[model samples]
Structures are given as C-alpha cells and as structure tokens.
Target chain A: MELKKPAMAGTTESSDVMITLRPNPEGGIVIDLKSDVKALFGDAIEKTILEVLKEFQVENALVNVVDKGALDFVIRARMQCAVCRAAEIQFDWGKEDAHGK
Target chain B: MANELMRTSLYAGGTSPVKMIQAGFYNEDCLVYDLEDSVSAGEKDAARFLVYNAVKYQRPAGKYILIRVNGIYSQELDEDLEAAVRAQPDAIRIPKVEYAEEVKRIDEKVTAIEQKAGLPVGGVKFWCNIESYLGVLSAQQIATASPRVVAMALGAEDFTASMSAQRTKPGWEIFYARNAILMACRAAGISAQDAVFSDINDPEGLKKDLEMTRALGFDGKTCVHPRQIDAVNGCFTPSPKEIRNAQRVLEALEEAARNHTGVCVLDGGMVDKPMELRARTTLAKAAAAGIKVGGVK
Candidate 1:
C-alpha cells in the first residue's frame, strides 16, 4: 500500500515505541531509530518494523522509530496502526495478522 | 462454566503497553483490555490494534481475558468487533447495552466474523454493560438474549447519570439496579459483575462498598486500579465459618445417604436442595481460593 499522508502512532512511554511514517515517493524504505537499548535490540527492532512494512507492502516510506523497550507484539501493533493511518484506510483484520508471525 | 473465583476483573488501558504487559502479573481473576472509555477518540484504532496483538500473541495464561469494545451505536463498534473477535479473548464486553436486539445484532455479527476467521461460532462470549435505566429494566432479556452471554455488569456511573441522580459513596441510588442485574443473572444462571468502586485511594470506602456488593450477591466486581484487586478478591472469598458450614452440610447429606434416609438434617435445620446447592458453591469457592475444605474437592 502506498502512503497518502504522514502519520504516527504510540507514545514514548516505558515499554512502548513511538513510530512516525511519512510518504517517500522516491522509493526505498529509510529507518531512523533512537533507542537506549540500541546496542542490544536495535537490529531486532528494526527488523520487526521492516517486516511489518513488508507485510503491508509499504516499500517507499521514511520510518522514524523511538523505542522505549517495547515487546515484539507492541512494536508490530504500533507499526500496523501507523501504516494504516498513513495509507488513509481502515484496518482490515482479515488482511493483516496481528500475531506478526 | 465460567471461572468460579472471578472476584476481580481489572481493567488495563489498551493504549498503555506498560499496563497491558504488567496486568497479567496481578492476582486479579480476569484482565479486561479496555478499548472504550479509557482510550481517546483519535486513538481508537491504535488501541484496537494494540489490544488485538496483545491478546492474540502475548496473551497471559490462566486468567480470564476480556476486551471492552465501544458502545453498539458507536462508529467504532464494527471494527472493534472485527478485531476483538479475531483476537479471541474470553469475552467481548459491550458497553451501554440497553436492549436484547442490540445483543442479538452483535451476536450475529460476531458469529459472522468467527465463521470468516474459521473459529468456533460460539467460542466467543459476551459481557453486557447495563448502564442505563432502559438497560436495568431490560436486564432479564439482555441476560437471556444470546447463549453466548456469560455475564452482565452494572455501569453505575452511567446508570445514575441516566436516572438524573447523584452518585454518592453509600451507593443507595444504584441499589435497585444492582438488585435488578443480580436477579437477572441469577434467573439466567450467569455471572453478575458489579460496577467499579471508582475510589482507588480510599480502601476503607472500597471495603464498605464491597460489603454491599457481596451482600447484594454479585458474582464479581470490576476494578479500575490494581490496588483494588486484593480487596475485591478477599471480600468475595468464602469465610472459614462459611466453608465449615458447607462441609458440615455435605457431611450431613453423606450421612443421610449412608443411612438410606431421604431427609438430611444439620444443626436443627433441614438441608434442602437450595441450601445444599449454596453449600456446594461455597465449598467450590473455597477450593478455588486455595482453601482446603475437608471431604470436598
């Protein structure tokens, strides 16, 4: 899905990740991640976000992630919400897997 | 049958990941992931996604989980039901339920979703929130509206607001609604959950209110804060004296059965069917609370 507008989801609360998605029409997904645990779980967090974007077919977007040590499911949920909002569509539970498997 | 010891059903805001992650660690019997009043209007979608993933993937074990959706008339109800049904919590609590028709509609919608998702059609259950005078009057019908209805809770704040009455600490204003909901639940053989105490800091007030809640025969109580769970669970647990009496009642029945007599007597009183049933329920409650009752499982 193509991004129609810039959108963001989640808060910077403890055990949460705030994600900002902006439309990047030129192509290629760009990620800017800020996390205290970047040395340990940074790659894992980036992989989770990229997987969600791939599942939604969102190829061209600028992803900004501020991680507060969120779990995998929390990260996936926030990413899904951000993608849906940026694409200007309602969430379709049938098309999306909440479990992120 | 539902969990026998559902003394406390604690609400965890769906938008708060920290609360959701920590909610299961509490001793509350049920964890309610709330997507309704606790969430802001713009964050409804976010809350739904968060709750869906929380329940579907990271669900906590051994606790009855419920997801409170928006009201039936709200625009978010459809999508909320879609995600909630697929997420597969123990039940979906519909807020501000006032009529049987609304439940029937939700029941049908849930059935369709379950079928589409290939889940058991009746595996999902309902917990209706009766928050209006119309809801109070239609309690019986709502309790019996669908076979999936496992419990009905009184939303005292909204009920009092609907009646144009002030809500006081004593809670006399909601007395009738409480009894109405309890009677409907009893008649329908489902759990009757009481409203939240709403005074998190006042344990004394919560205890006093819980006295009435237990006296009114509510099966459980909704809790807004984690600190209230222990109090609610303690209030609902069977006392030792009650447990001993239940044991005596069962022993008396056993003795009568061994003697080949139809009449069972205990402590100068007849142990009738209703009394025996209450005794068994008490013993069952004790057992669930991890209290050992002699000669009873």
Candidate 2:
C-alpha cells in the first residue's frame, strides 16, 4: 500500500517505542532509528524494524523510530500501526493479503 | 455445572504493559486486558498487537488471562477477535452484549480462528458484559446463548446511566437490575460477576458493595485496581468456621447415607437435603478459593 500522509504510533513509556512514518516517493524504504540501548541492540532493533516493514510490503516510506528498550513484539506492533496509519488503511489481521494466497 | 470463584478480575488497558504486568502479578483470579473504552480510537491497533503479544508471551502463571475486546458494533471487533483468538487467552469478554446472536457470531469467529491456528475447537470462552436494559431483560438468553459463555458481568455504571439513574453507596438504585442479572445467570447455571466499585480509595464502600453482591449470590466482582483484589477475594473466600460447619454437615450426611436413612441429625438439628446441598456448596467454594478445609489434609 502507498502512504497517504505522515503517521506515527506507540508511546514513550518504558519498554515502548514511538515510530513515525512519512511518505517517500523514492520507492524504497529509509529508516532512521534512535535508542538508548544502541551500543548492544542497535543492529538487532534495526533488523526488527526492517523485517516488520518488509512483512507489510512497505517499500516506499521514511520510517523513524525512537526506542526505549522495547521488546520485539512492541517494535512490531508500533511499526505495523505506523504503516497502517500512514497508508490510511486499517490493519485487520483478519484479512488475507496477496501473500496469504 | 459448578461455577469457579473468580474473586477478582482486574482490568488493565491494552497499551500499558506496566499496569498489565502489575495486575498479573497481583494474583487476582483473572486479569482482563482491555481494548474497549480504555484505548483511544487511534491506538486500538497498537493496543491489540500489544495485548496479543502479552497474552502469547508474558501471561502471568496461575491467573486466568482474559481480553476485553471492542463491542460487537465497533469496526475494530473483527480484528480484535482475530488478534485475541490467536493469542489464545482463557476467554474474550464481549462488552455491551445485548443479544444472544452476538455471542453466537463471535463464537463462530473464534471457532474459525481456532481451526486456522490448529488449536482445539471451542477452546476459548466468552464473558458477556450486560450493560443495557435490553441486556438485563434478555440476560437469561444471553447467559445460555452459547456453551462457550462461562460468565456474565454486569456493567453497573453504564447500566445506571442508561436508566438515567445515579449510583449510591447503598446501591438501592441498582438493586433490582443487579438482582435480575443474578437470577438470569443463576437460572442459566453460569457465573455472575458484580460490577466495579469505581471509588478505589474507599475500602469501606467497596466492602459494603461486595457484601451486598456476596449476599445476593454473585460468584465474584470485577476490579479496576490492583488494591481491590485482596478485599474482593476476602469477601468471597469462606472463613474457617464456615468450612468446618460445612465439613460437619457433610460427615453427618455421609453417616445417614451409609445407613440408608432419609434424615440425619447434626447438633440436635435436622440435616436434610437442602442443608446438605448448602453445606456441600460451601465446601466447594472453600476448595475453589484454595482454603484449607478441615479433614482435607
């Protein structure tokens, strides 16, 4: 799905991550991440962000994440929220995507 | 068809893992991860995902985990059910349930999810929140609507608001509706849970309400805060004296049954069928509450 506007999700609470997304017409994903635990989990956190974006097949967006020791699931949820909001779509896990076929 | 004592079912918002984890560790009989009313519209998706993962991963042991999904009419109901069923909590509580068909439909959706996930069919159960006049009137049908429904909780605040009434400490305003719900659940042979006592700071007020519900034969009470758990559990837990009396009655009844007699005597009083049933129920409640009854090692 194509992005319709800038969108964000998640909270700044402990063990949560706030993700913001903007439409990028460049047709590829760009990520800028900030985390307090960057020294130890930087690469792993970035990997999770990319994997979540790839799962949604989001290829054209500028994704920025501010992490606060969020677990993998929190990151996944926040990113999914950001993508859906930016694309102006509902993230109904009930629906089958093209990939489900 | 004995109902378990869910002494406390604590409600926590889906987005707040901090609060949820606190509730889980508090040893309430059940922990309700709420996505309805508690989460803002924009954050529903995030809350669903968070609650799903929490149920799947961080579920506190020894507590029944339940998720309160959005109401049947909400646009988010399908996805909430989709996420909740996959996570596989003990049950999904349906808010604002007014019709029996609503439960049947959600049951169908849960069944489909179970099939798709290869879990046991009918593994998840439902707890209907009866909040409106229509719901209270049809409570019996809603209670017996599906075998999957194990409990019915009254949403008193919303119910009073619907009737254009206000809450009082003595609870006279809601006495009839409350009793009606209790009768409906009792008739259907399911658990009846009392509504929350919103004033968390007033232990005396909560105790008064709990006493009323207990006297009315409610199985438990829903809690909005962790501190309320101890008080709720206390009201439901059988005292040692109560347990001992129950044990004595059972023992006397056993002796009479051995002799094939129609009547029994305990403490110079007749021990009949109704008394025996009450005694048995008391012991069952004690056991369910994890209390050490006499002669039970």
Best by TM-score: 1
* Cα lDDT tens digits for candidate 2, A37-61: 9999989988988887777777788
For model 2, residues B1-297, the per-residue Cα lDDT tens digits are 212458789899998756766676786888889999899987788898889878776777788889999989889998898889888788899999988988988889888878876679888889999998889888989999899999999998988888898887888888888898899888888888998899989999998888898899898889888889999998888888888888999888778888998878999999888888888788888889877666632
Q: In candidate 1, which residue pairs get closer than 3 Å at backbone N, Cα or C atoms, i.e. clash?
A: none
Over 4 Å off, model 2: A1-4, A23-30, A92-101, B1-5, B116-118, B259-261, B294-297
Colliding residue pairs in candidate 2: none
Model 1 Cα lDDT, one tens digit per residue, A32-99: 99999999999999999999898888889999999999999999999999999999988778875334
Q: Please give, for residues B24-137, the per-residue lDDT of candidate 1 as tens digits.
A: 899999899999999999999999999999998899888899999998999999999999998888999999999999999999999999988878999989999999999999
Worst 10 residues of 1 chain B by lDDT: B1-10
